[model samples]
Target: MLGTATDAYQPVERRLGITRRIVEVLAETGHPFSVVTKSAGIERELDLIAPMAAQGLVSVYLSVTTLDNELARILEPRAAAPARRLRAIRALAEAGVPVGVSVSPIIPFINEPELERIVEAAVAAGASSAFSIPLRLPWEVNPLFQDWLQRHFPDRAERVMARLRDMRGGQDNDARFGTRMTGEGVWAELLRARLHRVARKHGLRTERRPVELALFQRPSKPSAQGSLF
Candidate 1:
């Protein structure tokens, strides 16, 4: 995810190039693939994606976050980059850029309020769809997130951790395929339901439209170039 994408790169274009290469590989895998342009600002993103978008390209734009600290804004995210993520939507739409929104790391009691606002902004920006994942704290993310919570949200920190444990089958994570991306428990089910309700209210469908590959015919054998040995 690119928060200070344009702001903190030795050669920012190179960063996008690296990301594009990975996307190209996934696109060739013969499976339905998804691409999320992890970016903070839509303005800089346009300079990166406008040329990459062909007549019909499938992609999503997920404005990501992991902290609720205002101090971190100064150190990163940069106060100059307006907090309005819909700007990313509008710019991409104006350029005919296919788009959607991803509101991830939906930390409990922290950025949950962002859920509705993010959906509303995407709809207003002409987004065709939307998706979400509750806060996933795997690897060092759990401890790191806990530290962030204690620092920025000390009073409600205990409640947050409690809810997380409940969702994880009494663990921080269940570490299973179906249960990994989404934790398991009453609260987890509620979160998933809430996301669906909001998404439906906003006209964002989670069911992706199937791609029509019947039109993809192999190019006529290059006419053999009519070449002789």
Candidate 2:
């Protein structure tokens, strides 16, 4: 659907009202779509989404990096607090909208220890599924994140990079098709196993069903009528 490296509901969305209009159109067109957001601002548009969820045309996935307030602040300074994200998840689920949690860009030593806690918290907050990915530092992101890591976590920054390199086959990034998202080597394997175990323990969906393409339809373009010779 709509979610693919872009967040539909950003802070500016509150003012621009663009995403709201987009959601309304999706609802009217009966097109299934998903939104991934880091803010509770999405709550403002849930009224438009709830009815769509009844038709399985909408789903919301909130990204939470960590539950620790201190770490969360540093990790996502402008994002909604971890607690607020959970509340939004609960509210959406209460409204009969399918809700999911994404503990994305899971840093190795920083927030990896909180994996189980994060997933459990989402489950308690009514998430139907959960997923995560190891941090991938690419191009400029690599240097920027490294700088931040050094500034904030000087002691453990090198260790974190080392772990990432091991996962990436001795480099900062591994961009291969299958290995990029999950990475490789021991740590990556363990991470996958742990993810599966935790998801199973809480009865969350580990494998998502492919989107039903049949639900999508495009209005036919009108023909130039009466094109007489």
- Which candidate gets the maximum lDDT versus the true structure? 2
Q: How many backbone clashes does candidate 2 have?
A: 0
- Per-residue accuracy of model 2 over 122-175 as CA lDDT, tens digit each: 999999888888999878899999999998899999999999999999999999
Assess every candidate by TM-score.
0.70, 0.91
* lDDT tens readout by residue for model 1, 155-224: 9999888888888888876678898777888988888888788888977776543432433333333235
Report RMSD (Å) for each prediction in the order shown. 6.5, 3.4
For candidate 1, the per-residue lDDT at 216 reads: 34
Segments in model 2 whose C-alpha atoms lie over 4 Å from true places: 209-212, 217-229
- Estimate every model's Cα lDDT from 0 to 1: 0.59, 0.85
